[model samples]
Target: MSRSPCLLLLCLSLALPCMADEAKPGHMVYLRAVDPGIVQDIRYASAHNFTGHPLDGYQAPECLLSVDAAKALARVQTALNAEGYGLKVFDCYRPVRAVADMGRFANEPGDPLKTEFYPRVDKQDFWRLGYVARVSNHSRGNTVDLTLTGPDALPADTWTPSAHPVDCTAPYGQRWHDGALDMGTGFDCFDERAHTDSALINATAKANRQRLNGAMEKEGFSGYSAEWWHFTYSANTQKPDVMDFPITPLAP
Candidate 1:
């Protein structure tokens, strides 16, 4: 696919300010179109977000892609659709600013209690645990936070599969914590219990998580050991500085 030279220049200019022509550690950049298999679909999970609500300067849903990574994602979507499952993307190709926002939140004096999510540890522990790393793969446009939904929803449509708003504060099952029947925890749950193969939860939830893992692995994506919903496209898996660029889809 031919890339928009204007968009590319715009991306470079916006992401790499005049002060620094080169892409910095915390800057956003475009993904080269190496892979078309990676699919793009927004709206799989609840409108709920990690920052506890929508924040200023947020944009609508779109999939960003690294050339090869896009192909892998597209293939993954195709396979899932064949099985009557669809992808609901939370965030992809994040800009470095967004990552900074996360870090800033963690440093804040008042982060919400983690007992409901990271019950074993306090909210401050995230800083100590290194889960929220300074650099994330997402900025490279190769990593994504996602969830599975039924295929009835078209590739461009959004749907809430779990039926309720994503309650990050409630217990696992009631708040979307389990992995088996699909009502487990939200995708970005920052807890040890959200491990890809954790047994602290019920069997049903474990099975559900396993299903997600299986699907991701089949399409060249690997589940984060500490996160069930986090996946990295093997095609272009370089951990880059975090970015917060708005997702811009390739024009059809």
Candidate 2:
């Protein structure tokens, strides 16, 4: 006997995996965990993106402050999107597993400086710089790692795709934000030079760093002393759990 269309639809629902609609209310959410939360409500800021990759494995609520951080990010997204640039997050609401991964990888006695994670720094120096901490604010779901991109002077709807190439050895140049200013080192630079207000950098780079810092500070977000690309909206708020969740895209 042939099955009815309604019956076939029901069968399909059971057979296929369901994608989450939005973020959960109180529970810790990650790229891996999903619940019957609301749809995508947070605005995106693409200004700080690399190679046009989606900021996967990101979870709100935990990544963002309950009220102020969320609003500031929304405004940040709006301001950037208006200029044809939006945010692309690399991580948000990191799970405990992820933090463990960083720690495990850090403790592994091997050459990681030549590796993609910390290409510029020496394997032994990473620990001294505190770039690879055993515990990360990311686990608390308040840390974010991002970069700026193009679409400069174009309408948001007509923004063109741009690539963000990260080379460890290359001299830091104007990769993004043409007129805004330079932040001494590139977004991912792990050297001590990436400090928010380092005196070792050129005057122009210092000014540029200040510009970015001011924008983030106004929104109540503070920068990580080591890495200019890192920031947390809720300076003190942090979660106990750290996890490693892969970035899975939402299906159409």
On TM-score, the candidate that comes out on top is 1
lDDT of each: 0.54, 0.46
- Model 1, 15: alpha-carbon shift in Å? 16
Model 2 deviation from the true structure expressed as Cα RMSD, one decimal place: 11.8
Candidate 2: where are CA atoms >4 Å away?
A: 1-68, 79-88, 109-120, 150-169, 173-182, 235-247
